[model samples]
Target: MAWLSQYQAIVYGNGANGPILQGGRSVTEQAIISSETRQAPQGKMSALALSALGIVFGDIGTSPLYTFKTVLGTAEMPSDPATVLGALSLVLWTLFVITTVKYVSFAMRVDNDGEGGILALMALLGVKKHHRPSIVAVGLFGAALIYGDGAITPAISVLSALEGVNMATPALQPYVVPAAVVILLALFAIQSRGTAEIGHFFGPIMLVWFVAMAVMGVAGIARHPMVFAALSPSYGLSYLFSHGMTGFLVLGAVFLCVTGAEALYADMGHFGSRPIKLAWFGIVFPSLILNYAGQAALVLEGAPTDGNIFFRLCPEPLLLPLIGLATIATIIASQSIITGAFSMTRQAIQLGWLPRLYIKQTSSEGYGQIYVGVVNWLLMIVTVGLTIVFGKSDNLAAAYGIAVSATMLMTSALLFIAMREIWGWSVWAAGFVAGCFLVVDSAFFLANLTKIAEGGYVPLVLALLIYGVMWIWHRGAAAVSQRMREALIPVDDFMKRTQAAGIPRVPGTAVFLTRAERDIPPVMVWHVKHNRALHEHLFVLRVEIRSVPWVFGEQRLTIEEVAPNFWRAEAHFGFMERPHIPELLAASKSLGCTVDLADVTYYVGHETVIHRDDGMGMPAWQEKFFAVMERNAVHVSDFFSLPNDQVVEIGRQIAI
Candidate 1:
């Protein structure tokens, strides 16, 4: 009731189940986040429940579709009964240790502005001052790793589930690629429709899938009750120590079970953190553990022909139908990854960590549903290629854990920085926790490296390519912007000369959409020099990025009376939020400012960055990268919706 009361202004009465907009706008809340607000309605419970289903449920819900099968497939058909039981035992406990304890119980507590994800964590640790290169590198690397993780998730998730159809009915094997493509295309296609349209069904679908997995696993365990003995921690420990050289290598496959765990945090802003933790502890966790144990028990009693333990868990009579069910579940899991990639890209652009790519919001209130054409088509091509080349989900398994594990390792390393530097947490306490995570993460990383020749090269190459592009763009753009700044006219001199010239005063307000919050834009300085008198109201506005996306309201224009008649208003937007200056200006009647929207002139500064072999310490390759980026960066007028009659563009040139 209190949470609902806080949101009373935004909550309009509903029509059936669809919420109606009232005074302002509403933003959706993700699970596994500790934020104070949820997407309207009732801010607390419903949000938490949906987020729990959306965020944490994706990775684990889909794991039952693949984990046991991949583990046993390593030994080929007629999987060793003893080894199968042992490995399944290993997976069960791994989920308990990694998911239940590390993530659900502890990591969800570390949130930034009610946002949970690697970027939020990085923002919490990042130095606000732009001068800190190490902090910036940490942020970029973390961002790069997330993008890399994004690309791989769809490939593995989709491929693993589709492989089920192949195992269930060998006749369906040839249709796998076509089926996967259709599923993937459908996944991207529905993104424009918004998750809110279908989100209500996600909980029920996941509930059914979990129930099916549990029922299947329970049936297997009934046949071989002794498989429960594998629950002991000693079984996992014994397998690792006893296997000689190959034991270390098995960790690569083992790590796949926890691959989507980070999504639990990354997508936390979409769903609240509480529900995600709840789903894992209450439903997802118990179901996954039971299913894994059942697979192990089935393997111990008798080996299957093709070594697909997951499919084998189902009786032959129902195998095909179950395969169909698993395929649908995996499709949803893959869709979650694709959407996560789009969200991460938007965050990077807003934070100035990435070059602007065209971003389109699909839903008015549901920020999670989005469509980025560039990301969608590119991901489809890469994922389809991976399925064709790897030919099986087990091969993709090696590459899968490496990028995500590295991201987790890097996040933990940065979390240590946050503890000591930002939160002022004790060094010993931070070191102990971070050190343990690092050790676990590193072990997984090394194991995955063994997979490089065995189809692990895909994500590794992808991560490197992504990182290089980001670094180059950052360096090149800085050089170009710096030179442009040097060439611009000073604001003080511009205002003085223009006023002395006795030019006529403008009747309307002039608004400059700026990227910087403090300094006067070069174009503004020039405008004041040329125009003599300021508009009735002058606004030098910049968008300030929050840690989370679309969660906070736009900053109110900070109106200051600079001179008797001159006024300046600054407007800020969160990194995850969009600011429509024109719309905000029109709506300013609530802020006690009356200005006709048609009469107001919006001014934008456009920079043309060039390479002159001069300014800053940039490498030759980086200079080339900047040239490409500058060519690619969208014009300021186009990015911000401003009219042709009222828009003014000032060009400044820079060389890197």
Candidate 2:
């Protein structure tokens, strides 16, 4: 068993790097170089647009499935004709201002070197090396919002779609919860199977769904043509100010329609900025607006007064079929948000803002299907818990938009900075755009705050927990490293003592899997002392992960032979990626016979951190968090993908 494990690690080394090693032979020519000279496979703009439209917009696209229904269910959205029209107007205009004008037309153009999303924009704006603390907090909060959304997306999306079944047939209403549970469970259960296999069908299905939404809109539009008047901004403004504080309160829930807009930019790297922009303009935008308008029209024409506005728009004969399609759309929508959460976590891990979690890549072709077992199960528990606690889509709706609105506000702030610093745009230009974004986003954010007593606190509480853990992890890691620096054994002193003792030299390669980017681990010093000789080639590798999701595979790893046999390779991974060191070692060997794995011995350094008055920003409670995290982190040998027999573990003590 031990020999088998050793051989497995050696043979599988670099297999994760994708085909660099086959039949134990290195394929240097086959390797993909991550440079301008290397071009990604191309596709037609139309195909790319359709694909991006489906994958990126599912969450936002399916908002029409329940946003209007949920808003109308609220007490603030009046049953009266005037106020109802006003409320509908507000929803429509909010979509235009926030989703269409602000994000679709403007924000999508502000790319961070062809990368988008909150973190990439932050990086482009130089968030880290400058006003780091404040910007990092903002980024963390933005990240926390995604986590909050992740928990609720499955519950809300699945429940809303399932509610359509009950809408179509009151007989099925009794089975709604059970049906929803099964669908939600199935959605998550397939995550480990990788999305690429089924991913191709996503676009075609969504396109059909959008057409169905548009057709439903056409039906309602014929009945009440005047409902198109909601496109004017005056009604929205009137409703916002006329109804006083109550109208202001409903803005929070109204903001739910655009909860998934950020995802469009976050996933820009996958399908390219142009394709997403085209899809939003050409297909997604019109269908969603029309669907919402159709719902308003249906309500005006005195259609049976059912709660599910979306499914109600379809003809009676097609109700069940529409429910089936809506359920599929909602599942895709939930899948996008869940995958988005995975991407955000990966970015956070790379930027040193998150504790390393076990990340498993579940795809051979598509980068999207990733399973973080810990995150997946935890989110499932939270999602199911929320479903039971809230018990209905309306209750969950109250908690939905608060985190998203806050994150949007943060993105606007970061965008303002990026305009001034990165693009060198004039202050007035940046301020003008920033001010409009702030006004709209701030209204939604403040409105959400009003719902704290009504379930909005869930996400806020979750965000604080997530933020605290991140802050503590960063502080503790820094403190531990600082202590190591102070206690570092100089290379000269160690060799003198080991040589004086006449220790026998070991003739094998020693590999230490380290986490630090700059500092050498304590284990490296000890390994040389105990053996009294260096392997033919000694390496100190640093793996750097970028904050963006879906980094090109070839760009995923950066290897440098910093010194003779002293190589430093920084493995870059998306949050959904799994780390396999043996594969990296094998890949490196293929590049050149710089390090010999046949005679190699892997070394891992294990550290135990003790907390003191450390003066790191943490309170006593957070110190305990650090203790818990240390206990749960993957053990050294297991984490390094090393053979236990050949592996040497060195323990170091540090006080945080």
Candidate 3:
């Protein structure tokens, strides 16, 4: 109830779910987050719950579209009551245990400053890429694997929906891939236009989608009341033990039912845990159960699957309409993961695990409505290629599941740490709780592993490529930063030497962006040494991105006068924040510092990396790899929103 009280005013929230809508990134929350009004409208919970249907459950809600079909194929057995009930039971409990129990109930409680994600969790545990602890490396690798999910989710989701076209007009099967291509292309193209304008419809559309799913499920369940028997745990366990390896392998397909469970926690900061929980239990949970149960019931009645069992649940008259709705729902599901990749990327950039890519703010509605050109296009290419290569949802299913399974396993490992470090849980208690998740997650992961030769290697290869780049960038950047620190001059010594040499003073504020907190930056040393002058007012600004989700009000900027007319200020931003140096500097006047917006010059470093042949640094190839990343990284001026006309780049070559 107290957690419920923190979100009393997130009324009418239909914003997309991801890390991007946390404290600093959301416009809707910004309008209401500052206020402490505890009195909520009577309908607030239900309204927030309704809005959550679109954003929170889009992917998992559509699981029935392909999950049951894939599960039946993997089972390779009869549609007898025993087999059907066993598979149904597995699907039902997997949703309950993994999606509801693991993510919504447990993981959401471990949020960092109310932001939740693999990266945010790493930040919470103080896991840095440079440290390279086993657990830390696992977490980073897990985060990198999600990029593979980003590529595959859209391909599978959209392909599954379009496959329903065959159920209606069998002749149109040839055009399914091309139609999916066009739809996918349109989806990525429209990402630059922002989801704000059409996002409101997402809630109502998903509401209809869920209701249709539940109705279709209930209709089939009515044909056989014994289908409810599958709701018991015994059915699933009996099937697992009786069938042995066959049932074990089926867990791979069953895992698909909880595929998007990560969104429940990742989007927790967007809409609070209360509304997401409400949506799950009140609507999403029941709907998914009914739909999955419905599909199983249809199979049990000896009803032939007309290409797809999910489409078969509908009457002939409604089949086409259902297919159309599935198409839309799948697209929404695709959007969730694509935006999730964008959100993860920004976090990686701020935390130094990634090179700065060109980030475009596609909408003023919310920062969640952002586009990363590199991430978007790469995802597009991978997704389309997967779609074309696989040519059907069934084949794509083999390529899916592994990445998310590994991610969940890594999450369980991190949650164990959070319990001990943050919650102060006893090792025994933490291990017991985390052990259950690990067992389930590991079983799913191992099951999914069998899919590698069946095309699962696609995502694994993508993930490995991403992790390689991340590893190099993080270590490389840290090395460069360390060397730069080593080369910095102590402010007192540098100032005394400059004063003795009678350096000329120019009259304007020169803000030098540096990582140093209390020393003269190398760029500044170069500026004074070569230019032979110093600004009358010099501000050494260090922008720090904290582990939390937000740094607000008085907590954001710390300013001190290290010398007369020479101030050293540290502007703190959360990983979720978009930092604008000028705006923050303008706000510095509030903290007893005078700053002129019009007459300011910004100075930054442009380092060119060169390999050390003696091998004190990284290997020669790694040095070259870092050099290529640096060459393509976004300029510091654009990244910080600095004015181009007033900014200067001081070039320095670092041998690493």
Question: Which candidate achieves the best TM-score against the true structure?
Answer: 3
For residue 361, what is the lDDT in candidate 2?
A: 50
True-vs-predicted CA distance for residue 453, candidate 3, Å:
0.5
Give the residue spans of candidate 2 off by over 4 A. Answer: 1-43, 75-81, 304-306, 492-504, 513-520, 528-536, 546-597, 612-620, 635-646
Give the total clashing residue pairs for model 2: 8
TM-score of 1: 0.87
Q: What stretches of model 3 exceed 4 Å from their correct place?
A: 1-42, 128-132, 595-598
Alpha-carbon RMSD of each model: 4.9, 6.3, 3.5
Tens digits of per-residue lDDT for model 1, 142-191: 66766666666766677777777665667878887777777777776766
Sorted by lDDT (best first), the order is 3, 2, 1
- lDDT (Cα, 0-100) at 268 in candidate 3: 74
User: Model 3 over residues 1-656: C-alpha lDDT tens digits?
Assistant: 54333342231222222222212333224424523221334557676676678777888888889999898888856576788899999999999999888898899999877778788898889764245477668878899888998898888898899898787898999999999999999998888666666666777899999999999999999987789999899999999989989999999999999989988888777767777888889888999999988888888889874368999999999888888999999998888788778888888888778998877766543545667778888999888888899999999999899999999999999999889989999999999999999999999999999999999998889999999999999889888988888887887898899999999888889999987756988889989978999998888999887877777767878999888888899988777667778777887788888655568999999999998767699998899999999999988888787878999889979989
TM-score order of candidates, top first:
3, 1, 2
Per-residue error at 248 for model 1, in Å? 0.7
Worst 10 residues of 1 by lDDT: 11-20
